[model samples]
Target: MRVGVDIEDGGLARITLRRADAGNAIDLAMARGLLDAARACAHGSVRAVLLTGEGRSFCVGGDLREFGALSGAALERHLMAVTDALHDALRTFAGIDAPLVAAVQGAVAGAGIGLAAAADVTLAADDASFTAAYTGVGYSPDAGVSWSLPRLIGPKRALDLLLTNRRVPAGEAAAIGLVTRVTSPDRLAAEARRTAESLRRGPTAAFGATRRLVAAGLSADLGPHLDSEARALAGLAVSDVGREGVAAFLGKRDPDFTGGAHRL
Candidate 1:
């Protein structure tokens, strides 16, 4: 399988891209594997998810070499199949309750950029670099790049990267809000694990609500957004998890939200 999934104790799920030989390139099989992994995470009781690559580079994008062999109708069919699977995976990852943390290293290009951008929190290794390779390859954006990029770094900056296809280094990427944190290469794995662990012990449903609210805010008008926020807040306030959190706050204790304890 081109994707590996490991669900650890305490509801932390780790998903790794496993095509190290090709910089974890997304082939049809990889896309299918990704979709399966994503579906597993969403369907399970995972509290947090960690996404990373298994080799030197995070992901170099699609398997263009595979594409190079096809032409005309064959190429069209192959492309559609790959995108169908990839889009399903992306959609599942974005809609799930578990917060996503991506630990990226080496090169992140094309669809890889979209994957990183979709993360709730992205951490980059010191040596990490990002590029938008679509235009250079005589293609347009896919893998949710067009939808996530502009929301991430603003439309103008997103356009500049898309049009120029320039490489953005780790530090610059963090400064531009492309990544949440940048750590030394030696410490990247440990830091990412620690971050996911911390989130695993948090209120999973609350984390999901915050993420969804932010997504909703992008397209919602002020009045409607306020109404939506009010409704969400009210819903959470009465939830079992919310009551436990309130009690914990009053008693100066840690809140526990495990095993559907948060439901009522």
Candidate 2:
């Protein structure tokens, strides 16, 4: 596989897109590798995931050369399969008990943008760039960009970016709320990893439930999701960990929760 994955203390796994020479472009093999890594992270001891690039660029986009060879049914099938698999991979990312933080530097375009938007939180280096390159050529946004963009930057901003294929830098990206935080290139990794570690060491199952509720709230009305949230809270409120947390807060001491979910 062209990607690399390592899990350290705090249950945080760092997954690097390793094709820096080509600006970490997603080729066929790399797409499969990314999906595999996401699935592995979903099932592993990793509570949080830090997505990054090995060298200069986080990910330039999909390999254009790979697109040239396709035509008619073959082309349609190729594009559909890759995008579908990638979307599936990203959808699973949301289910991760701990947050998914993207540590981005350099170019992030096309499918790369999709990957970034898939993350629960994004941390970009001062030099990082973002572009929706799909319309620049003769393609459309995939990797659930249509779904994610409207949620991140609003529908109007997403339409403008997609229509114009504009290249946005870190400062502008942060201002527009596409990325959560931006730091100096030297501190990007540390900053992102720190956030991931914080999440990893916190309430695992509660985070997972919260994530689901938030996602559900995005598309559905609060009236419908209220019931779901009520059920989740009810379950948590009766749990031993919750009682301990409440006691610890009232007693002015740190909560010791041993009822951590091993499956997470």
Off by over 4 Å in 1: 259-264
Query: Local error of candidate 2 at 8, Å?
Result: 2.9
**TM-score of candidate 1 to 2 decimals:** 0.97
Q: Rate the local accuracy (lDDT) of all candidates.
A: 0.91, 0.83
Q: What is the C-alpha RMSD of each candidate to the true structure, in Å?
A: 1.2, 1.9
| Clashing residue pairs, backbone N/CA/C < 3 A, model 1 | none
Q: Evaluate model 2: give its lDDT.
A: 0.83
Candidate with the greatest lDDT versus the true structure: 1
TM-scores of the models, in the given order? 0.97, 0.93
Candidate 2 regions exceeding 4 Å error are 257-259, 262-264
lDDT for each residue of candidate 1 in 1-264, tens digit (9 for 90 to 100): 899999987789999999999999999999999999999898547889999998899999999999999999999999999999999999998888789999999999998998899899999999999999999989899999999889889999999999999999999999999999999989999999999998888888788778888999999999999998898788888987788889889999888877473421
